[model samples]
Target: MDLSYTDVANRYRRQTLSILADERPLSVSELASRIVAHPSNDATNESTETQVRKARLALYHVHLPKLDESGLVSYTHETGEVTVPEGVADDLAEIAETFRSQMDE
Candidate 1:
């Protein structure tokens, strides 16, 4: 699977991918909170609960499904867990680092 930022350009998706690469097997709510706290997202004045809620909804209804379909992640809705497939975790770490640097620039 091409895990390139070009292929996964959405900021939320990119942040989710980055977080999962480093911290596998995160609960959906926890992952959403991490994504919201990730530096790549512009700081907002919104309450933490609101930010987390929005992130969670997006992950559950959209990003997770797309990433799961692409085989980059394994999301179990019943358990609300998200994990990077081991086969891709190393590659994802490398790719995510590269793109994250570029994003910082």
Candidate 2:
């Protein structure tokens, strides 16, 4: 199957992916909150509850399904947990680490 790099390029999805690079098995609500708090989404800072709700909806309806389909993540709806698959996590973590290092330079 062709990879949907578009899934990774989307703003919410990108933020989700970036976030999961360092953390996984996060509760849906917690993940949504963190996404809202990400630097690029600072506009959400002033509207925490609203952003969290929107992010939760987006995550449940769009982002998580796409990422799960890509085999990059596993979303357990019953448990409300999201986790990066072992195979993909290492690669993404490495990329995230490198990007973080470059930003620090």
Which candidate tops lDDT? 1
lDDT score for residue 1 of model 1: 57
Candidate 1, residues 1-105, lDDT tens digits: the string is 565544486777788777777787899999999988777678789998999999999999998898888888899999999998878888888878876897788
Instruction: Report the Cα RMSD per candidate.
Output: 1.7, 3.0
Candidate 2 per-residue C-alpha lDDT over 1-105 given as tens digits, one digit per residue, 9 for 90 to 100: 234657666767766767789877798899998877766554534568988998899999988998888887899888889988877877777656654564345
Clashing residue pairs, backbone N/CA/C < 3 A, model 2: none
Model 2 lDDT on a 0 to 1 scale: 0.77
Off by over 4 Å in 1: 4-7
| TM-score for each predicted model, relative to the true structure | 0.89, 0.82
Q: For model 2, what is the error of residue 33's alpha carbon versus the real structure, in angstroms, after optimal superposition?
A: 0.4
